[model samples]
Target: MRILNLLKIAFKAIVLNKMRTLLTMLGIIIGVASVIAMLAIGEGSKASIRETISAMGSNMVTVRPGADDRGPARGSGGDVQTLIYKDYEKIKEEVSLINYITPVVNGGGQVINGSNNWPSTIYGVNPDYLNIKVVGLQSGSMFTDAEVQSASKVVLLGQTVVDNVFPDEEPVGKMIRFNNIPFKVIGVLEEKGENTFGQDQDDVVIAPYTTVQKRILAIDYLNQIMASAVSEDDASEVVEQVTEILRSQHKLLDSEDDDFTVRSMEELISTFSSTSEMLTILLVAVASISLLIGGIGIMNIMYVSVKERTKEIGLRMAVGGKGSDILMQFLIEAILISITGGLLGVLLGLTATVFIENFLHWPTSVALYSIIVSFAVCAITGIFFGWYPAKKAAALDPITALRYE
Candidate 1:
């Protein structure tokens, strides 16, 4: 009965100072909302990156030509012609950790179907390229190893390519001209969406590496080499082995630097995870400041509340209320205010997240942990900030408080 009466009085007091209560809660509202929003955005981005990387094969490593220090001081020299098919074949034969190896030479130009033309990147790779890239055919069949060896003018269309050139017709067995050269479309790749780097997965056309090297670009070297390890755990080992092999093939002495850079999916994932965790921490830290401000606001209003209600407290004390009761009442009022603000902030945060996701077309994933953390933070803020004022109110001398105006 006593607790209920005290809670009733606290509720009435808050009701009487509606404007002040709302203003005090404003900081908490913004803090909780921003924390939730930032966390959701960060989680979504991390998930998207992981998905894209996983799609490219979990145990894969890419080797791109780095500037040869022997030829270039920084970025001026070191010609683009570095890696060759021989290096790819050597890596395949020499590295036991390697499960698949493929060389890629890419060219970009207009792909034409009669009067219709679309700009797309054309990749030339072998049958092993599909395995290394983890690409799957949605329609028709991938070019066989024989076609790749024969340098056949056969191509595979990505989904976006299909939409652009053969919207209404089946692309398989259809011919598309690239740079006036006719190449038959043998297959279409399933849509893998965009990569984390914002490159469209569907806007690519793939052909035999030999064809792109000899017939189209007349290039004798590769743009990049992709290799998949026998197992994900062995990816680092495989990268080291491939790097050694490339270094040897390029005739780089031990004293010389590597002319290529080897990157593994594992390393990239770790870097992304570390970077994301840092960003999440930074965002939460900034949001916590708002919570602190809100706490201070609560403390200020609570002090004012205790002052304004001094006469009431004196009357209650004189009528038989103890110091602990006065302390409990004020503490309860502070907790109620915080909890109310927390509930409202949670709703506002979730609603704002939904709005941003829909309006901006960016993915957002709200985690249950975020809600739990926010509530805990709010509760703790209440106790910590409300302690001083509640203690002050409890220690008041009833006789002196009665004399207070």
Candidate 2:
């Protein structure tokens, strides 16, 4: 039989029962649409998180105090401070992987300017801190390396601090008091928005490590250290080198554990990337269940169609159409229904993704692979679900169908 003739017969049958055909296709439409939308949302969230993490400087590494392994054999308090300026010095001198190193101590207080004060956080670090973090100065200048080493009580304000404290005045060389000790402001940092951890980078102040250590904290030890590797590929090696240096400098043998943790940007990015990708796959997997249900619905309707048209099938078979022809006609009809529904679902899913992305202000990206996968799934479901009905119709006894009431 001619495919067009068979397709015409199929079309006539569907047109005869338009409402049934529409209802049968509803499941496929919903399933395809959900899968596309869910995948788009997942990809968008993953991209957003990655951007947030990158904004903190992709080549950076952070060193923080970890559980002390060598101190007093577990319960003893001999751990003391794990991080100190001497460790920073050794890492800079001995580790070739480290490009820049800086010690940091943080405290929060209300910043006052002519009776207009804003509560903010502060970081005390060396002049190399800006270079290591790739932080740019928006106006004025950063505290010179000379000033940092001299403990010259100089400070740099962030953009947010500038907006609040000296909105109408030039803050260069102006005095801002921290812990009631006045320090001259030498520069302002460029604006950096919120990080993945939800920290406002532009809401804090930066002061020389010497001044912050001796004056504010009044301690010789550092709370944390920030360093940057030459490149992302070298980050792990840099971490290993820094760990060994700190361990050796602190006089911990191989028998004793280290008291510090070193984390690389590549490690963090990979962790977040894997987590995001898995979540996306999981969401898509869950949405695929809807597709399965829809496919089953299609199969159910196809079965009903074959039973209700049994006599018609026998008439066609007796007239000259072979059983194979009958099967092909029915299978093609199912494919047409599914393809139509699948295309519509793709359009609807794209529209919904656009609305969601624009309304919620999240990143949404639709990969071409998703569309191809969706359509392929639709076709597979149609063929798999249509098989039973096609086979049943092909097996119909012409005499029995002809005598049907």
Candidate 3:
């Protein structure tokens, strides 16, 4: 009966001061909403990066020329010429876990079709390149092993090249020049669009590495070796086997460090995930400041509320109201304000996230934990901030309080 009366009194007090209560809760509302929005953006970005890397072939591994030791004796990794065609052949013959392998060489040049030309990257790879990359042809077929052996000047155009260089005409079965070196178009690749790094995946041309090495770059060494494991689970095993084979093929002693760098898609994914997580943590930390400010707002408002109700407290005390009852009454008022504000904040946060994702095209993924945690924090804030003011009201001398103007 006593608790119900205290609750009624608390409810009555809040109803009498609607505007003041709302203004007091504004801090908590903004704080909770900000925290939720920040968390959604963070989680969404992490997922987006993982998905982009996975689409590039989760079972793939890349071997690049370079010593990772960063020693003064070793030049930059991309500039190293340690990876050769023989190293690729040795791995192909020795490693059983990989399902597809290709020796890759790349150069940047303008691809010309009549008067139309676009600056694009040309990737020299064998027939297995498409298989390793997990991409398929939209028209025509990939170059055959015979073409690779003959160093035939045949090319496959990505969607961007087709759009720019052959907008009104079919790209397949046509002649195009790369750096003034004429080539026959064998195929057109499907549209892959931009990746997570914002690089255009479609702005490329692929041909046999032999053609690029002998005729274009005049280089005898391979730029890189790309392979795909039979299964994503086998990627690590494939990496290990390729490393051992390359080391043996190079005739390096056991004590010598590797002259090449090998990395699997799984490793790449893990690295990206870790970095994204750190960024998420940072964003969430910055958003948490709003919650602290909201708590402080609650405390200040409760203090003012106690001061304004001093006469009411004194009259109640004279009318046989217990100090504990007065304390509970004010504390209940604070809690009601906090909880109501929390509910509004949640709705605002969800709406803001949707707006950001749909209108602004920003990534957002609201975690259930974030909402629950924010609400829990709100309740705790109410109790913590409301305590001292309630205590002060309870300790006031009834006679003295009644005499105050």
Candidate 4:
């Protein structure tokens, strides 16, 4: 038989039982849609994380005081105040790979601007902090080096802080009090949304580390040190250089643990990327179960179809239709069902992704590779599950089939 004739017969047979055909295709549709949606969510999360990390500066490295071990009871890193302002100065002068360095001291207090008051975090950093973090000002200018040296009570407001404290007024040159200590707002940072950890990136204030350490927190020790390598490729080298310098400065012998910890942005990115990829794989694996179930549904329905059309199969054989032709017809019907379902599944998956992103405010990305993979799976499922049933139909004996009621 001609291929066109076989296709016509196959399509006609499927059309005769539209409801059954649709029911059989349901599994494939659901399976494909689930796979696409799950993968899209995973991909989107990975991209978002990468973007957030990059926005914070991919070449950045942070140094924090290490935890103090007290005979099986260990204190948190923040509990130890081993890092000092002198450490920051040494790293800045000694590390050639480091392009920017700043000591960080943080405190939380209620910020008051006239009748409007909001609770906010206050970050104490040097003039280099903004450039190191790749943050830009929306208006006004950063505090000068001279201002930092003088321990001036000048500050930069994050977008969220500006929204809460100075909702109706221009923030620049305006005074906001933290813990009732007035500081002039020199600049406002551009909005940076949220980080991967869901922390508000623009919900704080920036000031000179000296001012924050000496005036607000009233301590000489630094909370943390933030630095950026000249290039991404130099980040690891910078971390090594920072570690060596800190270890030497703290007078740690070869047998003793260092009093500080240094972490590179690349390490953070790699860790998060691995986690996201694993999650994506797990989700895809779970979604694949639906496709497998759908394939099984195809097999079961095709078996029933073979039994119902046994007499028809015998008649076709008696009328010069080859067994191969019979097999091809049934196989084509199965393929048509799956391929149609797959196309519909693609549309459904895309709709679901858009809904998730818009309504849930979650990120979702549909890659072309995912679409192609889903379609390929559909085609393979049709062939693999339809084969045995097609073989059974082709094997029917005309003599016996004619005798049946």
The most accurate candidate by TM-score is: 2
* Alpha-carbon runs more than 4 Å astray in model 3: 1-9, 40-60, 68-101, 105-137, 140-155, 163-167, 173-186, 192-203, 208-222, 228-245, 248-251, 263-286, 310-327, 351-367, 392-405
Model 3 agreement with the true structure over 125-204: per-residue lDDT tens digits: 99998888878999999999999999999999999999999999998999999999999999999888887678889999
Task: Give the higher-TM-score candidate: 1 or 4.
Answer: 4
Using lDDT, give the best candidate's number. Answer: 4
Q: Candidate 2: give the clashing pairs.
A: none
Please say which candidate is ahead in lDDT: 2 or 4.
Answer: 4
Q: What's each prediction's TM-score?
A: 0.71, 0.74, 0.69, 0.72
Instruction: Judge candidate 3 at residue 63 and give its lDDT.
Output: 97
Give me the displacement of residue 2 in model 3, in angstroms.
Answer: 7.4
Of 2 and 3, which scores higher on lDDT? 3
* 34 Cα displacement, candidate 3 (Å): 2.7
Stretches of candidate 1 above 4 Å error? 1-20, 38-60, 65-100, 105-122, 131-138, 144-154, 159-169, 174-184, 190-204, 208-223, 228-241, 248-252, 264-287, 318-321, 360-363
Q: Which lDDT values do the candidates have, in the order given? A: 0.85, 0.84, 0.90, 0.91
Worst 10 residues of 3 by lDDT: 70-79
Per-residue lDDT tens digits for candidate 2, residues 122-176, read 7888877887777899778888788887888888998888899998988888988
